[model samples]
Target: MSAVGPLDAALTVPAPAVVEPGAYARLRELVAGGGAVALTGAGMSTASGIPDYRGPDGTRRVQPMQHGEFVGSAAARQRYWARAYVGWTRFASARPNPAHRAVADLERLGLVRHVITQNVDGLHQQAGSHRVLELHGTLDRVVCLDCGEVTTRDQVQEWLADANPGFLVAVDATSPVRPDGDVALPEAQVQAFRPPLCLVCGRDRLKPDVVFFGGSVDKGVVERAYTFVEQARVLLVLGSSLQVMSGYRFVRRAAREGIPVAVVTRGGTRGDAETTVGVDALVGDVLPALVADLRG
Candidate 1:
């Protein structure tokens, strides 16, 4: 596989190194002959307005709250909800983009068996892909660490708004800007904002149903994805740099098992050397073309 950057002169000088018009045809040829799977990351959803957590920029945005911090202190919980309250609307209102629809089309054509995604956004399901396995849990849901009660994140947002009316009012009056539900607010205002307690237990603690940096996903989820890989002939990775172990491990696993891996991303990936085929292109542009070729 080529270790080319998006702007590498060799790839971009004359023309882009896009998959031929027969790209999807090639994909179908591979699939009909054997099993197929897709592994996706944040780039797939960037068209929908979500920023890539770690891209070429190398900026590490701080999460709203850590499990250890939220559980240990009341002030931490308040700060979390204050930011989340302002940010939830952007996340909830984001519509799936063309790249999402392209994957669903592939699934409909029976070429894609299962989708393993590192994104917490539920865009794939929203686009009508059924057999999706979320390696990182969905951000649209909330889980109580104490009682294990699961609820939609929308409901949690409502509770947060009610508990912190002042904060909500301030957020509404502002520019309505949000980045992955972590809007930029003044430290003084955020410090003044309070977090909502769990509706069931009435405790000032609740966490989103997402895996954090130091968090470990359930072994069962990992095993299920591995099962998909084991039954598949090819693993197509999309829109991920694979900087994190969660997504990188799958690429390594496929290579070890002799399965061909195809990657489509705008930037360098951690496992580029191990990939069988790497296409450095926007996922939105490449996916639809690939799907069209498959149908042709």
Candidate 2:
């Protein structure tokens, strides 16, 4: 959810191509294995007042931040924090959409085993899905890379509000909310702004607890995800385009091992070749109906 500038034109293009129209039955059959592991992405959160980086058509709407830029460049850090400060309220206000609720309901019905989400929004958890593994860290929290101090993102926003009064209204007046709790603002505003630092240590780096683009997810987290996939009888991928290899690698591995893989997304996915069933439909529409049918 963090990007500094316009993405290269290559990255901005989307690849959403709707497949055949029978995703509901295909998804049902895939989850019939009774131990399906759910893999989710940004598209899952679009209905919860969040804008996805890639639209339903699979085109990129925003270029995400690279890890090196946030950790290494002071100016990048300031700009990111400035936008995030303004966008925090918008991000915070997002509630779990029906898609999120349906996922949670499936777990309650003993149909889903675990949820592995690429998004950092924590909306799945908010929607009441338990045993969830966030592949990327969450926006709701912050971590001090220096001292390992963990605090709520709200705390940092409060600090930023005190330091940068009138900041949000100034930049937010023009910028719209972007996915990943980000906003697009002018460089002049960013340069004039001051970013937050580690409050506990008084001098060090503080970043949202998310795994940035080009950053590696923690090994322990990756290992745990593999373990879940190993125990799973089937893999159910939802809403992701699988453009990122971190999430796509699991699908590739599952396919190699002959595990049942079903995908329900609105656009073309890099893993379509590997999917046993590919559904081209809106998750919000498909999931709620599926959940209702499951309950009935």
Candidate 3:
């Protein structure tokens, strides 16, 4: 994958209402045929009760944990597991919403060919999207950095429960949850929490199977996503700010290849200028309406 910034050229559509008729019409027309790929982000899961990293205005609400820090500092790992252990309960319970269903419906209608998501949450697959690719990896698994053995996150949770009895009960549930599926906690609580060890290696280097900030996605995965976009007629982006280059690169690729790019998201996106049609709205609301319009 290549490192990049914002695109120099853009289509510059005006930001529309929550469900602008004109923008919706253009979106419907673009995806009317099969061969569109849906690239999603945190905003897609917000309807399922999961919060995003940024607000509607596009300002970041919290600083995410970096990969370097998590790998280099033992203290960082301890704090991460503590917050994650508590936050997992809520994150795991998040259900797929209307937008997810609509995207699945698009696939069933043979409009959308594949889904490439920046979200680590597995809601797309849960929503019945068979051709789904995870760009950043999923949180449902754990990897041992020492032995390189992979294990289920459920097993790690069990180990954490055993090591830190009553830890969850002590944590304040109101603490803000981050986009990475962890919550904020006091330093004292974070310090008191004991991190889980890898079952295979019996080492303390168990990390969630996710790409943290400052982490690189696997080359194979990036290549696959590129191929999907390269073959697509339209690149339909849902609920993503496209702030980071990971997802933004696909948008750039679509634009460069003359594939029409449509963005449906709340607030502004870094790829707004590059979009063929830009709709500033909730995807949950827009997608269902689009599905209804297409059916009609």
Give the top-scoring candidate (lDDT).
3
Better of 1 and 2 by lDDT: 2
Q: Give residue 97's lDDT in candidate 2 (0 to 100).
A: 93
lDDT of each: 0.74, 0.81, 0.87
Off by over 4 Å in 3: 1-17
Instruction: Kindly list the per-residue Cα lDDT of model 1 for residues 139-235, writing each as its tens digit.
Output: 8888888888888888887776676676666654454434345667777888877666677897666788888666788899999998898778889
RMSD of 1: 6.2
Q: For candidate 2, lDDT tens digit of each residue in 46-101? A: 88878888866667879887899988987788878988888889889999999999
**Can you write out model 3's per-residue Cα lDDT over 1-296, one digit (the tens) per residue?**
11112223332333235667677667766877668999999999998988888898889888998999999999999999999999998888888999999999888888889999999989999999999999999999999889999988888888899999998889898986678888988999999998988767788989999999999999999999999999998999999999989999999999999999999998889998799998888998788877765655
- Ten residues in a row with the worst lDDT in model 2? 1-10
TM-score of each: 0.85, 0.90, 0.93
Once fitted onto the true fold, the runs of candidate 1 whose alpha carbons sit more than 4 angstroms away are: 1-34, 57-67, 172-180
- Between candidates 1 and 2, the one scoring higher on TM-score is 2
C-alpha-based local distance difference test score of model 3 = 0.87
